[model samples]
Target: MIHGILNLPRNIWLIGLISLCNDSASEMLYPVIPLYLSSVLMAGPRALGIIEGIAEATASLLKLFSGVIMDRTRTAKPWIILGYSLAGFGRPLIALAGSWGWLLLIRFADRVGKGLRTSPRDALLASCAAPNQRGLAFGLHRAMDNAGAVIGPLLAFALLSREVPLAHIFLWAIVPALICLALSLKIRESAPAASAPKRVAFDWRLGDMPLVFKRYLVVVALFTLGNSSNMFLLLRAKEVGMPSEYVPLLWAAVSAVAMIFSIPLSALSDRVGRITVLVCGYTAYAIFYFGISATEKNTGALFLLFGLYGLFMGATEGVEKALVVDLVAEDRRGTAFGWFNLTTGLFLLPASVLFGFLYQGISPTCAFLFSGCCAIAAALLLIFFVANRRP
Candidate 1:
């Protein structure tokens, strides 16, 4: 499996490296931002919910359009490059922030870069690999991404352990972001193949998409409605008696588990089936969320459940994209990915808000139960209604 994955492609490997750098930088800030909001700025869960919801929704709107742009342009590298550049510069600006509003502004710019880059990047990844190897290619990319997530928090932990100011640590994220930008420019872009047929008019009409893709989108949107911002999980760890400084390690633990399991599970998907692996991943998510809902101050249980949550992410994240590619025509992949991301993001805002309110106004158990139930429903729906086709 390792040898096969290593044989993917030069562009795939480079893309993974770029993802590593980008995610490394992003995770450095991600686990810290909530803490910065609550502890430093003295904000509340609702504030966190609003900030994440708005930031994600802003990115979703851009994702809705960026796919069309990429399809029209028939090139991804330029958009990918531009997106990374914005995020690279934008993330560091949080260091100067004195209020949650400033953090919100910084998040807006950063996620806009994400919204711009994601679909095009997925398009490029699809274009570079053979159809048979899409699972491996995406899996490797996600593994590298999660590996970076692991390293980023460890780096943050190191810096914080030395008594570095939290805001100052935000500035360090720029270094990896710059590295990601520099490496992204090295990706070689090719014009569309002459043998390829001309594409239809690029638009957001859902009727234009294939039935399989549309059905898959429904399942995806359902699942995403429960996939609230991970900040809630971090906050849960804190609420369960984990100390503030140790939060990054908890995040790293999750990422490390994700990094470790991504390749094996993705490769398994290639052999068994995409939907099978997807269902398993969703089941794992449901179980983990349920466990989180029920557990108390048992640090051992929290750690174990968090690691399983990582396994859920590893199994689903990249493989789901590979499945998306399989369900659509090659020419429409960018648009398909765009819609996938757009709808997912669209639901995330409300998801985050609902989870936040549950956590604050009710309890963490209520929040986790809601998410777990949603995951189960999405999984059952996919098995029964969406995954009937072989592709």
Candidate 2:
């Protein structure tokens, strides 16, 4: 099995490994951040919203520029290296933060690294994989990604349960980050072939993207508008009376399900079609969110909802990236992915903030209901408007 993975292209496995390490590092920190803010820092829902909004907003603003810069320079490896290193260094800062403001700065720095690397890294992965196996490539990457998510949080649970300090957990994450950096250095760059022009004008425009890409972006934007921050999900679980100690276990369960399903769902998308898998995933999300809204304080119900949410994530996230590559030309994939991230991420701020307000003003259930409605609308739009248009 190890050799089989090794037989895959160096770039493919390397990207997977990098994702594994980075996500492990991230998962170790993310689930606890909101809890820490509320419990330790005395922040309210509004402050959590602001921190997430600012972090994602910073990431959104940088993606397009990062993609254009990577394309123009005909260099992806250096940026990838820098991005990962920056994110790795930034992770520890959260543990050291004295206030929500400091935590926001750390989150912003980390997201900046994500914005810089994501498009170029995805383009490189696409370039590395055989066209027929792009789904598998992305799926394997996501599986490995969530594998880290599983390990990181479980580790957090173990350490915290053993009376290990949060600062120690944060500092320890640097180990994986360093591993990722070392692995990244060994992965060969898959930059697009440079033409005789030496440098090309940065003429990539959001308006100039293909119609299919644009339509898909619209669908994603709509879905994301409802797909508020995961913090809300944790908060919902808490509201439903899940013990604070059990929250990480709940997250671990979600990651475990996502890890198991991602590769199979991605492979299924490869065999069937991406749209079929994505539409199904979106419909599942609609139902899952609706369930979250309608249900009361039942651990069984919350577990089931989280499991379903994981399935939806497994089916959609990596498969969506593969579809983006399929719809765009090889040479322009970096720009395409950048624009996609930019559009979706820019919407995340408003989504999270609005949901936070709804949760505070009306009820948590109301926020989830709103999200469910948006998802259902997006699913319907995709089914009616965009499903049959691909060719």
Candidate 3:
């Protein structure tokens, strides 16, 4: 199995494996975190929103700068190594968080690591694959990462079923992270990137990028406003009658679907058109959120909706990124991905905060309906405004 995975060019599959292990460590704590904050630490949805919101927003702000630095250095491996190590080290520290306030700092630190790595890592992925097959490469990456997500939650479920404490589960996350760090030590930069002669000038201005890419960024920002934290979905699972003991498994199920579907669907985008898949994904989100709003009593329906949500993720996550790769120049790939991450991550603060408030104040149904409408609007705009250029 290891040989089969390693048979690919070392530059590509190695990062995918590293991401798999890293995500295994990170996600081991992901599903149970809301439970930890709500039950043990005595917090609310709004508090969880604040933690996720602040952590992501801070990471995004850092990403904008990190991309510029990465393009100047022309070496992704060192920054990638440091970023992965920081996040690996950060997750284990959550066991020591006495309050959500402390957890906020820890989450912020973890996401700082993500910020440091994401743009460079994405640029690396773009470099490794053929232009025509980028969707396949990125799809494979997302699949591996989602595979780890499946593993992590299943591990959490097994531990919790065996009556292990949540804090101990957090501590156990360190093991996979250590393995990930060891693997990352071997991630070499491709020869050209390692030996590049000139530095790419840093610029974040709109005029510096492609016209279509700029318009696409506008569409992306619009979509991100409605795409809030997954914490809400986990909370809704319990509200709809899924037992806390089964929540990890519920999370695992969704990830499993994404893992299964990511490769095939993303490859499909390489053929028909990325925009088609993206529109489909946004439409799926609208339906899933609408379904979630109505699924107050049926655990079965809630599980199905979460699975559909995962399908939406599988369809869009990699394909949309491959589209980004298609739209931007190779030299400025880091900046492109940086802006992509920024647009997605920056707006998430208000999205999550507003979702929390609406769920708490107006009603869960009202909040979900609002989000569904946003998804529909984004999909329509994507179809009409952003032209998919197949090359």
Candidate 4:
């Protein structure tokens, strides 16, 4: 089994394996962190918000620098390895947290690792894929990542069922981290071209990214302004009377569906147009949010809506990375991805905070309606400004 996986295309298989292990480690701890904070550590909503805010803030701040560093050094692999290793090791630190302060510190460390890794890893993935197959490559990576999402929670569930402590689950998660570390060593770095400069300045000017990519980035930021954390979505579902016991199952279902659809949808974008498939994805999100808003107490409908939500995620996540690669020059790929993530991550804080307020003040339905409207508006923008203009 190991040999078969190793014998597959090096880039694809390596990325997939790394994602599998990393996400397994992440998902094992992520779902329970808030609960642990509130229940065990006696933290409140404010603390939870602060933890998440700081974690994401750390990621946003590092991304631009990390990208510039990767491009200047013309080396992505070392950054990638370091970032994942930090994140992998950081998970166990959460298990040792005796207070919310300690948890926040650990979360910051983990996201800092994420910040360091993402842009460089994306650059490496782009380098590995054929131009035309970029969408499929990213999609496969996401699928494998979500596959770990599926497994991780299930592992958590089993461990919890066996009366295992949450801390132990986190500690045991290090096993996957070790696996990811081992796999990271196997991925040979893509050789840089002779034409590529040996050393570019670490200072990336705003002018370096093209006008089209900038415009697209604006639209993505607009869309992300309404796209908050999935934690809020779970909170909203529970607020509307969905039991806690069934929540993981809903998440698991979404991951399962996304895992199933990601590769095929990504491959479809390779044959069709990336933008076209992406617009469809945005439209699906709009419809899904609309369904969530309109349905008050229908559990059946909620499950169906969540399933479709998975499909939307499957279609867009990888394709978006492929589209970034399409829009930017090879040398500036790291910067492009960094800018993309930075913009989106910046918006998420306001979006999530606002959504929480909306859910608190008006209604959860209003929050869903707000999300749906933004998604549709984003879809329209993509149709007019992006998809139609692309060949």
Candidate 5:
């Protein structure tokens, strides 16, 4: 397995390591933030939804423009480096947050960094990968990323067990984040001659793209409408009597499962076809959400379902990325990734707000039920509209 992964280019490995570090820092902060917002900062669930939704929405909007920047410059490294620097440095500012508003500002900055970097980073990865090995390369990257999540939460758990203050832990995230930044700076861009021909101006119209790509984006938007913040899942676990201290462990468990499954499942996509794996992934997500919705305060069931949720993530995350490369021209890769992320991000805010409303207005079960139904609908659309056309 190690030898298979090592067959990819050196830059791919470097980017993977960079992702490992970056995700480590992000995950270390993630499991703690909701609790901090609600418990320590005295915010409510709606506030939590608003903050997360807006942060992600900010990233999405930037992604729409960032793609054009990448396409015009025909370079990804500089943008990538700057984005990582901002995200890494900006996130620790949460330690100084005096109120939920302050936390919102910090999250917005971090997500802005994400918005700037994500498309370029993905374009960089695709550029580095061989056509035949794109699936394996992306899968390996996601696996490394998930591995970092596993380590991050365990470290958080260990620190909290030692009674370390949460603010101190938040500050410590800078260590890995900065390390990722340094590693990111080391990635050498392929020569410009290898890139798509320079277009005179940026064209933002979806009509110019392949019909298959547009259809895929529509399916993605539909799916994202149901996919809210994972924080809600963590909150659900807490509501079911999982202790606060063990929250990191629960996160670690989910990441561990993803780490274990991401690479192999992604490789399976390379063999079987990306659409098949994606359809299965969507099915898994629906089942997981429905299961969670139906189970009432059962910690054991929640743990199992969270692991299943991880499986859902493992199957789709990298595979979907690789699929986009297959759908567009090489020169348009950055733009394609940008649009994909934008559509997903566009729906993210309303999706999260809707989930929060359903949870507050009716019940958590209703939110999950709504999401499950949407996932099922999106899966069918993928089968008819996108998958059938491609495969």
Candidate 6:
């Protein structure tokens, strides 16, 4: 198993390295963004909700457009390069925001880069590997991403502990972001066959996609309705008696857990079945959210629960992308991934806002319990409606 994964195609490793650099730059801000909003800008949960929802929705909508174009062009490297450049440029600008509104605009720009790159990059990875090896390929990518997530938070924690200005730390995210952009230029896309026909029309409908792919999109949309933003999870730690100082470290811890498990669990899905692994991952989300909903001021339990959530993330993230590849024709992968990201992000548009409302209007417990219910519903849908469709 180890030897096989270690020997994945060169493109996969290069792309994963790019992901690692970008994710490291992004995660550096993840641990600080909410805190900056709440503590520095005097924003509330509602504002945070609005920002996350709108930003994610914008990204999702663009992913669809970007993917469709990438497929039509039969070229991936340019989109990938532009996407990284935009994100690298946009990230540091967030440090200049004096209000949540400013933050939203800058953040939207950053997500634009994310939306632009994601589908094309995933498609590129799919193209680089064999059908049966996709799980390991995607897993390696996600593991690298999570490894960066680990690094980002630790760097943030270290800087904050040393009394660095928050703005300076935000500025620092640009370093890895720029590195990612530079490295992306190294990826080479082969020329299309001379006999290939030029695409004349844009395709927005999934009318010709497999029934399984379509149903799986519905399941993802349903599940995403409950999967609130990670900001809420961090906020929950603060609410449950964890000191503010440790939250970044906690973020690092969860990423560490995810990085450790992502490759193995995703590779496992290749043999056992994608649906089987997805069901378990969703089930873990249900359990974790319910546990979080019921727990009081117990930091210990939250850490344990967070660890479980990380394990669940490892089980699902790469495997889900691999499953999408499994469901579609090789030629249609970029568009399929776009639709997949679009469905989930579109639903998440509302889900994050609703969670914020529940957290503020009723109780945090109510919000989490609602998320748990959605997870359960999604898991059941996976079990009954979606086929495993292993390659």
Off by over 4 Å in 6: 195-203, 388-391
Residue 326 displacement (Å), model 5:
0.5
Candidate 6's residue-wise lDDT over 1-391, tens digit each? Answer: 7898888888898999998888888888898998899988999888988999999999998898888877788888988999889988789988899999999999899989989999999999998888878888989999999999999888888888888888888889778977887899889877877876555455556786888899899899999999978899998888888777678888888898989999999889889988889899999989999998888889889889999888888999999999999898876888898999999889988999999999999999999999999999999988888865423
- Residue-level lDDT tens digits of model 1 in 1-391: 7777878888889989998998888998888988889889899888888899889988988876788778777899888898888998889898898999988898999999999999999988998888778888899999999999999888888887888988899888778877988899899888776776676876556877888888888898899889999998988888888877788989999999999888888878888888999999999999999999988888888889999999999999989999988888887888888899998999999999988998899988888999999999999988998877545
Clash pairs, model 2 backbone: none
Q: Which 10 residues in a row give candidate 1 its minimum summed lDDT?
A: 196-205
Q: In candidate 2, what are the lDDT values of residues 83-127, reduced to their tens digit?
A: 899998889877788889998899999999988888888888887
User: What is the C-alpha RMSD, rounded to one decimal, of candidate 4?
Assistant: 3.1
Question: How many backbone clashes can be found in candidate 4?
Answer: 0
Q: In model 5, which regions exceed 4 Å deviation? A: 194-200
The list of candidate 2 runs beyond 4 A from truth reads 1-7, 190-205
User: Clashes in model 6: which pairs?
Assistant: none
Question: Pairs clashing in candidate 4?
Answer: none
In order of TM-score, best first, we have: 1, 5, 6, 3, 2, 4
Give per-residue CA lDDT, model 5, range 226-322, as digits (tens).
9999999888888878888889899999999988889999888888999899999999999999998888767788789999999998999999999
Residue 41, model 6: Cα distance from true site in angstroms: 0.5
> With candidate 5 superimposed using the best TM-score fit, by how many Å does residue 182's alpha carbon deviate from the native?
1.5
- Would you list the C-alpha lDDT of every candidate in the order shown? 0.88, 0.83, 0.86, 0.79, 0.88, 0.88
- TM-score for all models, in order of appearance: 0.97, 0.94, 0.95, 0.91, 0.97, 0.97
For residue 259, give model 3's deviation from the true position in Å. Answer: 0.4
